[model samples]
Target: MKLPDPPLNQASEIAGDWPLHGLAEDMRPALAQALARGAAGLATIISLGEGGPRPVGAQMVFGMESRAGFLSGGCIEADVEAHARACMADGRPRRLVYGEGSPWPDIRLLCGARIEILVERLASDDDAARALLALAEAREPAAWISDGERRLCAPASDPAPTWPGAFSRRFDPPPRLVVFGGDPTALAVASLGAQSGFSTTLVRPKGPIAPPPLAGVAYRRDDVAGAVAAVGLDAWTAVAVCGHDEEVDHEALLAALPSAASYVGLLGARRRLGARLDRLRAAGVAETDLQKLRAPIGLDLGGKAPFEVAVAIIGEIMASRHGQPALARRPVSTPDGDGQAAKPPGGGKS
Candidate 1:
């Protein structure tokens, strides 16, 4: 797409509440909205040194009247926006440096790290922007390439960087959570997941006709298997089973265990894990898949409140998504038959 010559009138800056480290897909929606407002610019971190607050490929969209996303932890955004406005005005690409060897030495990063950001004026009909927004809406992976001026996008085959000097990024669909439960803990998890930028869906069999008061979470009143099928599990999806009903939990586990979901968690007493595993094994679940289950469902944060448990659960999911190693914990024995274990005191349900 060709750049528009001559900048439009400077519109009043309207602040935006966007995530600091939002995903590539997350930036697309705001970017589209910003483009719709006339003149807009895209600022991206093309390089980073040690101790940088955000990673490479982090982006911020600046419009004539609005801005979204963030480049730092509130240290250099104002300066970045200034440079972005200048680039928009000149219709030229600029490479900005900060922390070290920066033209503006006054703006220092608290982390004492250096970063290189590419700022360029982007047209509303830019091919890269349109492709990215369309792919994000369709929940498809895409590869983006830009050299501060020209931009290109295509369906992603291998999501790895290719071009040398230009910015290359692979955009994946946002993480998703399919939670099966309607209790307070379940509601808290679904709500927190949605707030945390996840595509969240809460499935409660025979639930109330009216949906819960949560804002971003989608409600499903179907059975576990049906809900799983309808929602469609993916490698970027997570499943949390916390119905507290034995049969319901078991059914949910059965449906989730053998799926493409990256994380599958079950909420229950640690002692009862063996019985659940045994049942799952007898039901023909592969041993490898059974090993993927995270029983007791969360990091051992020792908080019993519903929101606290939700925090632990979301923390664990984030850890998994970032490829963090699982914490060491005692293993459950593989005793045969449906052995019963005494449920412990209220710790957000057994």
Candidate 2:
């Protein structure tokens, strides 16, 4: 269904910071409020060039005078908000480009990159917004297509429109991190995961030891296998087993290995990893599948504290998610044909 432009006069300026916490799930409350007030507008990043601050499909929900998320760095939000107001006034979608050679010569993006934003006015009961929310809840990836006269959501596999000026943007579910175990380390990792924009969940088996309180993280009390299934691990999900219990770690690994999870990490020393692998193989997990597991999970950041380890783990997960090499190093050969390090990865002395 096509959404009509909202009345520009209906908005009133409100004072507060943008409520964004870096996840689409965090925008639900603002979206619902804007829709209920009949002042909702959708702003999305349709295209982003090299070095762009935000990736394509990043979006925000705007009310007449309030915003709930961010589209770019501080450089472009004001202009995008102004265009959104215009879209509401005219019942039409507006496309805005910012960055190098932009019409506003005075405004320069810090990264000197280009981005395209599409703003569309939405009504209180907009079907398109509802559809997008449904897909998000289901954790399904889909394409949002608009051709001026109509707006619709389709499967991710749908072909893009060939018509001139038509736009299609794909939206995927937010990345999820499921941490198994209720130890202090697990709590720290879960906290870091949430702060880093992942939908974080802490799962631990029911026992006499109570789980620690973790703010902004969902808590689950179930066996490892059940918890894995409950979280609905997808290709965007990362599972980390942090408990010291071998049985718990083994069960979590078994459950996660068969899934399409982008990362499966086990927290322990190198020695424990070998024993765990042996158990997993004895339990019928294939050797090739075991290769996907990251034992002694986390980058070698040389920090032994719980928080430092958590940072390393989250860093590795982010690197894996973005397809970046976890370690940055230049290899050098010694006279004996053995490898010698010139400099440590991520800028450090050898």
Candidate 3:
């Protein structure tokens, strides 16, 4: 199915309220509401140019009364919302563009980049949409494809089907964070992890200690070693052992090291980590596997507070997830001929 060419003169007004950054999982509630009301539209970024505010596959769901997710750095959402409303009215998908030389003269994307967005009418009962939602809800990886007229959803492990003039987007399950501890520090890590889009699970080893409040986290109670196995670590999972107990830390490390988890971090001092590693080696864990643990985990942010420590740990996890170096390097300023430091160009945050 072919999409209708967008009208060159079509323009949209500004929407005052911008939505928050979120993934497909976070937008499920809004999508469900939209579907129930029979007035929902989905806008997806199918293509993006260099320096675009948002990457390809970024999406937003719009309901008659509310919207969830974001498409850009707060520049084109209003216009996108207008296009989405139009799609809901006509039930026809259309491609919209913003930024340099855009057809919509009223919208000027300040990011100095271009993006192609596809807006389509959506319903709760849509077979393809429901399939995609189910995969996301289950934290399963999948790929979704659409040709504006037709949509297809496939498991990530399956070969993608080809469709001429279609755009495809891969959706991975949200990164899973397994925090082993019931302490305040572990609670902080889980809380921040949840807000940062991780499917956080707080695992407390069986004990007299009470569990932390689980407003946005999954609570698991098991022996430290058993909890690791119960969580079923995957390549997208990160394990953080924050308990100060030597035995608990050692057991958690043993389970995490041999798993497919991309990151395994333990909170402790250098000497403590050394003792733990020795214990692991004596317990039959291979030296090579023991080396995989990030003992005294987190970058050296130098803050001693629990929240600060959580920030460092989360930051390190993100860097590791993206294959980034352990240490962040700041741009070095060069001296100009006049003996003044030359400032970097376009220095503001993106």
Candidate 4:
């Protein structure tokens, strides 16, 4: 069965002022009342002139009772409430940004991302309201909410014919992980990938067979593009090469590297996988494209066994899934005269 979709929320940084949980709670009754009357309730969000502190998939839902979709840890809800109340009072649409790189400690946390948030006054006919209605009616993840500058849109399996909302964010299909090989380590890694909320395909090269813990998994054939064909793989997906067969690993790498999967990893130590990369590149993979592959996958957890190794690998995948900053992976550089040197970030940087 498919996984339940995550709720949608608008970015606070896009709307100048962060949304207040208390304000949404307070606003709920009025909005709910509007919904009760069968009238349309529209909500619009955009990046503030700068940015807000929220993840890409954050959301805000305005029901009759003013429910908060996903919010910042409720740190600055008071200010957000005041902003919401003022917007309701003034009957106007406005733009605001928390930080412009100045020293506003509250707004400008050094998170490395810029934010811009927009809160526009919406009536029944507003596009955002209509699109939101579509999502609400069908429980569709098709609505991609954007703050104008940076948008987050996820596709829906069954979307309504027309999206009556006025929001434009690049709609991205949900991310998936394509796991190759049918060994215990591969299964363990796939199991952890499922836990991290990725669509996984367990490829058994020998033929069709079932694994033990068949929960939250979608097995696939070992042929080329099997995972890609089974479930759509965009730049968000991560492909990992595990299992003992070098032949199987090579085929999986050949299939995955060129695709749009965001992260490509091969489960092996440095020396072994490094040779594979060299061969793939020598076989015509570009230098830049070759850089995208993550060999010696996972963090250096000092792990030594299958489960321990799986743990480290999963940690890396988790970091990649959420776009988390990668930890340093130590590397050794060979000098021109055959000398070697230690590089920055360490071996686990990939």
What's the count of clashing pairs in each model shown?
A: 1, 0, 0, 47
**Model 4 misplacement above 4 A:** 1-57, 60-171, 321-350
- 1-350 in candidate 2: lDDT tens per residue? 22322222312222364535334434555676788778577787877889787877677778866676776656667666777777777777876667764554455677888877778887777776677677877888877776544677765766754455566777677788999877677788999998787889988788435555666788888777677777888988999888767788788889888778889877775534456677888999877677677655777676756788789889989888778863532221111223332221112101
What are the TM-scores, per candidate, against the unseen true structure? 0.84, 0.80, 0.83, 0.52
Ranking by TM-score: 1, 3, 2, 4
Best by lDDT: 1
Candidate 3 residue-wise lDDT, 28-124, digit = tens: 5577677777767988888888998777887788887777788776767777777788888898888887776566545666777888888888765
Report the candidate with higher lDDT, 1 versus 4: 1
Q: What TM-score does structure 1 among the candidates reach?
A: 0.84
Candidate 1 lDDT, 188-251, residue by residue in tens: 9999999888889999988998999998899999888788888888888999997878888888
- Top model by TM-score, which number? 1
Candidate 3 clashes between residue pairs 3 or more apart in a chain or in different chains: none
Q: Which residue pairs in candidate 1 collide?
A: 268-350
lDDT of each: 0.78, 0.70, 0.73, 0.52
Model 4 scores a TM of 0.52
The C-alpha stretches of model 3 lying farther than 4 A from their native spots are 1-18, 21-39, 207-211, 326-350
Q: Model 3: C-alpha RMSD to truth?
A: 8.0
Higher-lDDT candidate among 1 and 3? 1
What TM-score, to 2 decimals, does candidate 3 have?
Answer: 0.83
